[model samples]
Target chain A: MSLPAEERVVVTGWSCLTALGANTETSWSRLLNQEYARGPISCFPTDGCRVTEGAEVVLPELPWLPKKAESRLSRASRLALPAAREALQHAGLLDPAGRSKLGHLEMSLSTTATSMERIEAFVRQVWEGKSPIQQAGRVASYQAQQQVNDLQTFLGFSGPAAVVSNACAGGANSIGHAFDLIRAGLVDIVLTGGYDILCELVFCGFDSLQAMSPDRCRPFDVNRNGLMLGEGAAFLVLESESHARRRGVPILGVLAGYGHTTDTFHLTQPAPDGTPLEKAIRKALEQSATSPSELGYINAHGTGTPFNDRAEAQAFTRCLGANASGVRLSSTKAAIGHTLGAAGSIEAVLCLKTLQTGQIPPQLHTTDPEPLVANMLARPGALLEKNAALSVNLGFGGSNAALLFKTP
Target chain B: MNTPLSILSWGAVSPGGLGVEALENFQNWPTTVASEVADPARQHLVATIDASILPEKWRMRPRFRRASPISHYMIEAAAQALAPHPQIERNRLGLIYVSFIGCSVYSIRFYRQFQKDGRRFASPMLFPETVANSPLSHLAAELEIGGPVYSQIGDKSCWSSALRTAACWLHNGDAEQVLVIGAEEFEPHQLEAFRSMRWLAKPYTRPFAEGAGAVLLGKGPHSGRPSIVSLKDGFCFRSRNESRTAAERCLAEFAPNLPVLDSAVGWIRPVAIAALKGRTVHDGIPALAHEAFGASCAWDTIRAAQRLSIHPEERVLIPYWGLSQQIGAAALEGTP
Candidate 1:
């Protein structure tokens, strides 16, 4: 499963927009400071739902794009473009004059709610018998492809673009696909990421499932009830090592391995035993050629739900075995809440930052760690080992993904 | 670029009818292409499927009680494809589902409920089906496909991408056999959107259709199936002319010296026609239109495989272009 030197995919540039801040630096600082971003939901009415708090990203106008283009973009696309632009610029690939270098570039985006707001508006029009099909089609941008299409048009990227829609695992799977494409030599560089925005559909959906926590999310805590929804986007500029070397860009980290699995047990619930998740973690480690003893930190899926946190905790013990107690584990979801489809990439950026700074942001809002994972849970302001780290994501339809990253 | 894979079995559920039999007897099937939209003035031809044709077992299954129409189409098509090889281990099977607009019916319902009745009325059942991966998940659960599964959301060229993923998975030893499905459901709103975008042709010459088609891919050559020669995909950003040029260049890169039977559909037809025009054009190649169905790639691939299966000496070339300027091409050769 190991890739050759020429085929090894490395992270050259990365950017993220989270509820805590607009950029990576600001978000990282806020995370380290243990600041909670959750607040009363204001984007839409949470009238009947018990849960009213969420981490909503306040979007700012992008001067880089034309006013018309900005106005036309869906909220999801608007959040994604800035993060992608920042990643490309960080990799020194954003210059319009150097667009030819992007001939082999590709883009993969992930999202659970792509323009749900616009779709809601369209639905309202249709329901009222005031349907303006043409204008609604232009305004709604309801199809998942429209997100990628908007990015392609805005960035002028000619390479293949696709959207992975596996709910919460969408982001991680998107990055995993990018890694595979690079390793298989299909493309030299890939702009891979995930984005999602706060909408009534998601908020009410989670509420109806009875899986939303009314209070702040507390990951790996005995009293953890349910997850709190959040919104944001994250992107990583992944390139084959040889391509990065040729371009002379700084390597932030190496995308060591990725593993994906599905739990056919249920459509919305994790398997109680966490067997599938453990297998996914083992697969990632096996593919990366890294031993459990070499692992430093784990960014748990840790949605703070009763099922997800417990299952993930058991998965850690089963996968890491003797090394489980020694590895630093925490869920940043406590600080930024759960970003849904964007959770994987956003957590991945945090993992890369942990590798760079040797600081593992603590699991915020959890004073009492769950008994099973207490020994592995990192406290506030804990220092991490400068080694390999693992980030995992689990989605609604039992889709699971684990990504392994290491300092170069 | 490496050795091609084989298409062991295939199935389809289109306006023509259900399963491979319907596809084979398509000519005799009634052509019911008309608008399903509420507005009479905005009428546009669309091919609709009859869900009543699905098997009782599939319809009565508890898992599919709340399933969307697209999911039903996909499950039925997949069942037909897997019917021939029940001995294949479920654990070694993978699923890759592609669509232009996924689960639009459920999406509209979910949004409408939220917009009208407020947040509390959002149905949890409808919410799960609203996601793009709903069909793929439903199919995997129904068939017990425990291996790697991926759901891709893209324009028309997504078929080539699905093929590429399946090939890679097989090549890398991830799955012994992969079922790739392209399914689309007929929704009134979607047709309205298509009409607004002018994607539907006027005068009802070629009607857009809704259906699902599937191809079961396995390693090496099968006794009676066609082997996939190559699959290539690319994105074009410059202009329409540049996109066509880029598509042609990519098509040329796949089996350049071989004589190809052009079966391109929709906007990609010009690219295939141009490639053939440069060389000597061949007669007897089928004239398929894009407006047949949203899963046109699946139909095109199935047709090409059938043709190549009969004519072993000829290679079938399939090219696709999306409204977003994404382009892709595939080559299939028959095994004697």
Candidate 2:
């Protein structure tokens, strides 16, 4: 499904980073080779962390980022801005006039702890009910923390600045919301993206939930343990057709159609039935002009969790019909790790890259899968002749999202 | 501009008052004072009532046991608003909680822990709520609302943004109902500010106070209640004046008695003075409650409307201008 013809949002510029590469091209190349970013958790003091193995993203040691950024910037934003900067640079929308038309938008899940130690101090002092002011009085000495001033202030985001933070579907939700804003004649150009940084709090939470896999994340694999958490960001420059034509911006691809739906089933679990994902997929097609058969590749949320993969596989079959088995499917997490909040946005960048260069990133570590996802690991990043793909993301809140793309 | 949705049921907890009687007393009050969600402890926070025996209703579905008072007030108000519509299931409900700063204690805790343990140790229970959306996620999970959840941390307009988020869910037909909540207590910095001679010297001063508010948006089945007054077709305003214009346009049909709530340093009886201005309003008047909740966060707006349910046909609008002016207005359904 493409957007209601009148409201289709086109992708004019985009950039991203993951275990595969720090920049878009390098990352794409790494993905095709099935090079998994697994190694020691070198950046942080993982001696106290639960796991040692991670798809640790290698930074180029850019002078632009601060030494402390490894601790600050939440993995999501740090990953997001490069892509955003690249997209802006690509679309030639960095100038004064374009800035006005381009609105700033971000979908953030926990990429890093802005104040990595805020909670630990409270336990030391015992949460005294004496006014939060008093509590702060006791903990004031520990206040050497900083956070990005909500994308608007940090990036000088002028037009309609907003942050979307909805667990897994957040990035796609941000894109969908940006599409709404663009279609409704709000902003001509939309800098939309999502970011999340790896943090002990989020990691510990996942560990407690029994969702962390000891080895690399192998989505759809028969012996899947759980998910390996990763951190990164992705962003795309969205513009209306008229604006794109006027600026002569080289459209990377068109964000043909998308859909979002809430399962309303369980907080930590997807519905035993994949109705919500189906509804989102159907709506994405119905809202967009393209049919499911028109979709060349399918990026599965493929969290490697038993229920999610099963539900998602069934949902894919419902959408792709007889072509479900033929459609190219893979989970990039096999190379990178399950980057909770930033997964949606980063995958969007990956899908668009799939459109530009006709290649699919292999879902490494997935030699065998559950009966439902038998065909997911069959083909790695095999690019379809026509550049078009749909990426779906689901999260803890039973939130689901589907984003479609086509070559410009 | 999208016609702003008509507000149906609005409730608030501020220094001004709680239930119906307090709202009427507010209508004619001459001085402006911040509303108090609780009260300033005479001696390091002494408890007057047996909070232990007060049903402890929130404990049953507790997400964070040591959550700040602001979160406590938020849950109380949300529980009240959603309780009425029992048939409205929580599973499909969407929730949004917004604040410039959230339970600053938990934040302070996380920070202090980093200092003591060198960022190596953080309470896993508390870690989930440290993110801005923790409260929203906690609320949604408690209610088993497996729908879209969002949290925004910013100025006064956080509440309206959350409400706007809910309206999107409503417009998109994603959820059957959406709950929007906002609350924050004075941080340590402001608490120090309150202790200064400047705070003590306010001409019409009354010391520390708390305030908060909450509202719910449902698909339909509105029982003739004043609902979704307007759905203004535009983004929320940026500048204070721009916000005023947005407010004027959204509430154009329902002329509200706008009261200037002073968000400055030394506030007091004179602050109450701002609310007492006798303005002629067709539907209802704006009862400013700054003295009640001294920067209690956006919950003050909901409390303001809850305080306004007195006049049978009157509507209440609470506009807060801060870091960025976010005007939160609600049209309350007054019972005859």
- Highest DockQ model number: 1
TM-score, chain B, each candidate: 0.90, 0.65
In model 2, the Cα lDDT at residue A1 comes to: 18
Q: Please state the CAPRI-style docking class of candidate 2.
A: incorrect
lDDT (tens digit, per residue) of candidate 2 on B62-126: 55365555655566656766777778767577777656545565655554564456433546555
Cα distance off (Å), candidate 1, residue B176: 2.3
The whole-model C-alpha lDDT of candidate 1 against the native structure comes to: 0.79
Candidate 1 residue A106 Cα shift, in angstroms, is 1.5
Off by over 4 Å in 1: A1-7, A96-101, A131-140, B30-41, B201-205, B221-224, B237-243, B254-285, B288-294
- The per-residue C-alpha lDDT of model 1 at residue A349 equals 91
CA error at residue A19 for candidate 1, angstroms:
1.1
| Docking model 1 quality class | acceptable
Q: Which ten residues in a row have the lowest lDDT in candidate 2 chain B?
A: B42-51
- Write one digit per residue (lDDT tens) for candidate 1, span B194-281: 6545555433235567788999999888776899877778655344477667766766676555555544544445555675665533
